[model samples]
Target: MLPASTFVLGGAASGKSEWAEKFIESYDLPMIYLATGQIFDDEVAAKVAKHKNRRDGRWETIEEPLDLAPALASLSEKQAVLIDCATMWLTNHMMQDSDLSTEQDALIEALTACRAPWVIVSNEVGQGIVPENALARQFREAQGRLNIALAQQAGLVVQVVAGLPQSLKGRLP
Candidate 1:
């Protein structure tokens, strides 16, 4: 069967990444951990380090805080890539005032063109209270729109709540 692309959605600290990791481990292939968070402070750095410590060294780790399209396009068909989180990737792009439409288009194209399976983890940001600031509101709106688009293209979409996963689109492995 052809490899599938999955989108895992959840709130912060909702265990989406953990769930995605378990799913990737089941494939028994050369795994790739695509981390999109850039450590801007000690707290963020520690969190990133924790994630790295949890993964098996056998998996190749790619840290692309922004411009993930090129990195995704370079992978081989024998690999299974797990993007730890898309929220941070979006944050990285937005912080730099990057071209949102162009970046997202590139990302979607790269994901569709990937030869191997991929598990993408992202935050479900639309369920919370509305942001007080304009920038924060814009970010939430953009994230929500991006999630909707990704879900539509994904072969499988899973949602996590309080560490519990519920398959929303396709069958679970």
Candidate 2:
């Protein structure tokens, strides 16, 4: 397998996104930022804006809340793609009652087939207490399963904690 597929997983406020951003910056190729967030309120909008500002304006922005496979497929070998937080995308799919299995299959297929490097960021939501509601529990379980699947496919897997990155599977670039 090519060394282009990397997975970054961490808890909330764990600096995973920043780490991924810096890693992508090291590569001198054109970047595509695949944002999975939807601005539903001021707080979310502010958070999204902060991320946007962190990125160089030269990077192409693609706000895809779901259906990321097609976007990934459109990328070329010379471009690098940074998927900011797959957790939000999963949440969006869960909220819409979308089929998780189908989406995951499509994502894995795209990731495996893509020639360009992909830095996928996702929150590790299974480290905390058990959720109270059924929906929350389901989401947590789905996220865990998704992370596991992605990690298996990834050539490298890094878990960020307290702004420090711990390489779990492969060497850090």
Candidate 3:
């Protein structure tokens, strides 16, 4: 059986989403792909397309960039959810000038109270050099804080480096 919640942390292109997808697919539950990324340009559109092409028809995809509470609350124990990224979710909120603390708290509560098992993908932004600009630095700090909160709420925390998962908290199921 899968844990109630899993946090998959990694750098860009580290295969965290692919690993998490396989992890949840192993349980054979109906899958819900909670996509948080939004495409603003052709490059981003292509990236999104690439991810979409990866999952077969076994997945039901939901595109909600700002509010996820409603989608998450609609889940049942017969299903499993993959929040394909917390980074994009955070970016969406930040772009709209939403209050970070309030939104973060709501997300955490929704994840923990969810009936279905969930795996959340997030970027580990603190390991790199400090961002030079104010906005970039702010985002980096917020992402770091969000990762910490997610790690605390998750039963299993895996850090992916070069596409390999290393358990930093609970054992992988």
Candidate 4:
């Protein structure tokens, strides 16, 4: 059976989101795609378009770059939500100068409280060399912390690399 939640972690373009989508689809539940990416340039817009094209009528996409509480709260146990992903969500909050600790705590609480099963995708940003800029370094640190918390809360944790998934904490359902 699918667990309450699964944390999918990987580097950029590591096929994490695609793996998560398939994981959620296996359960045959109504799918809710909670998108956190915000388009500020042509590149991002094109990327978002690609993701949209990947989904069919089975998905109900919710575009909320910040504040996922409302959409998460509206889900039921009969549904499954894919929050693809945490990196962009963290970026949005960081750009707004939000309190990282407070926001992270709230997000964890909300995810735990959510009634539906979920697959949350996040980037493994700490694998690369240290960034030179302070902002980049700060983002890497924050993402690492968030990923840790998510892994701890999740019943299953998988790390994707080169389009392959390796289970970390629990067996893949």
In candidate 2 the C-alpha lDDT for residue 119 amounts to 92
lDDT of candidate 1 over 1-30, digit per residue (tens): 423799999999898898888888887889
lDDT string for model 4 (60-163, tens) is 99999989988999999999999988999999999999999899999999998999999999999997999999999999999999999999999999999999
Please give the TM-score that candidate 2 achieves against the real structure.
0.96
For candidate 2, lDDT tens digit of each residue in 6-106?
89999998899998988887777898999999999999999998898888776899999998988998999899999987899999998888999998888
Scored by Cα lDDT, where does model 3 land?
0.94
Show where candidate 1 strays beyond 4 Å.
1-3
Q: Please say which candidate is ahead in TM-score: 1 or 3.
A: 3
| 120 Cα displacement, candidate 3 (Å) | 0.3
Q: Which lDDT tens digits does candidate 3 get at residues 44-112?
A: 999999988989999999999989999999999899999989999999999999999999999998997
- In angstroms, give how far residue 70 of model 3 lies from its true place: 0.4
Global lDDT scores for all candidate models: 0.88, 0.90, 0.94, 0.94
Clash pairs of candidate 4? none
TM-score of candidate 4 on Cα atoms, chains taken together: 0.98
The runs of at least 3 residues in candidate 4 whose Cα sits more than 4 Å from the true structure, single-residue gaps closed, are none
